[model samples]
Target: MGAHDAGTAGRGRGKRIVVLDYGSGNLRSAERALAHAGADVTVTADLTAAAGADGLVVPGVGAYAACMAGIEASGAGPVIAERVATGRPVLGICVGMQVLFAHGDEHGVVTKGLGLLPGGVTRLPAERLPHMGWNTVTPPAGSVLFAGLPADSRFYFVHSYGVLDRAALAEAGVRVTTAHHGTDFVAAVERGPLSAAQFHPEKSAETGALLLRNWLATVD
Candidate 1:
């Protein structure tokens, strides 16, 4: 076999995709989930690792401010931004996605996000503190993320703050959302080579696993 054919037979062909460790994320869980999804994931806060990655996943499970602080402090912030700018898929989960936006308004804190997305995040109405529960999404007519979904499969979610009414991102290119807090929050989004979810796919069930699997297929 040729050298190129030999290189094609492995988990992502050792194509390291840095899993940003901002100290505010569930790094191990995300790492395991990605591995299970058939991609070799490397958890790192190191700036150098970012350069080696073919794609990147910035997973987080904390306040946006704290996570941003950790990313900048670790010097992975600018690197991640650079990665995203180069058209590498940057999968951000929950708070991670929030940080990709322009800013976030949570806990009376108005902090700047990575400015990758076009907008900012806002706190949910008083009626719902944390939009916790299982909610299904119906992705728009044509979406790459839900390419093989069963048409009504539900994904797990746990969060309160959201971008806005019905959908969190207008420029996200795709629309997928879940009913929550008497409104709709972006369950997932895909724009060009980038995609993100507002829920923890690692903790989610079969549906989540499938989601990660689909995402890994986009690395090339």
Candidate 2:
């Protein structure tokens, strides 16, 4: 059993949604999307504030090194560390997802990630640079993470790197793969209560909204 299943041994009992804001991210739109899904989300840069919140969304954009620095600087790092320790759901998106791993190989810069999940982040296949477009995501059989989500659902993506190795894929209990420019990448991931999606569900039209709605349903 992973940290999520262990920490969340008892059912969740809170409505506080903490969305981390270090320097940049699409939190504003994510907030709008979550609200549309009936979630009362709270956006903050304070790690302390995020630590105590019921659920946390670690979203990021731009440089991975800079984002990690911002998260550490804001003190949200330990909060996330603790949250992961608690087994409560902590979702990271895009660069946010990269942060969950031990490290990343981007911009020739190898920096440590949240180390929440067991693995390292690597660059996407050479065939694909920054995968920027729409694609279909097919989730694994036992995945309820995308419960009610349509199969082969299309989602918008603009990412350069993704989880590539099979071991890394298994770390994510429910493996959700998405195709980008003929290359397959892990679109959505969930390791126990810890979940994340490289594609911006907030921008994924109905498919994205369905993901958000499903996640929101598990918030409390």
lDDT tens digits, residues 58-116, model 2? 89887778888888887777788777677777888788877877777787879888887
lDDT of 2 at 156: 85
For each predicted model, how many residue pairs clash, with residues at least 3 apart or on different chains? Answer: 0, 1
* Model 2 misplaced stretches (Cα beyond 4 Å): 1-14, 126-128, 171-182
Clashing pairs in 1: none
Query: In terms of lDDT, which candidate is strongest?
Result: 1
Stretches of candidate 1 exceeding 4 Å from the true structure: 1-15, 165-168, 171-179
In angstroms, the error of model 2 at 7 is: 28
As for model 2, its CA RMSD to the true structure in angstroms is 6.4
Q: What is the TM-score of candidate 1?
A: 0.87
TM-score of each: 0.87, 0.86
> After aligning candidate 1 to the native by TM-score, how far in Å is the CA of 110 from where it should be?
0.7
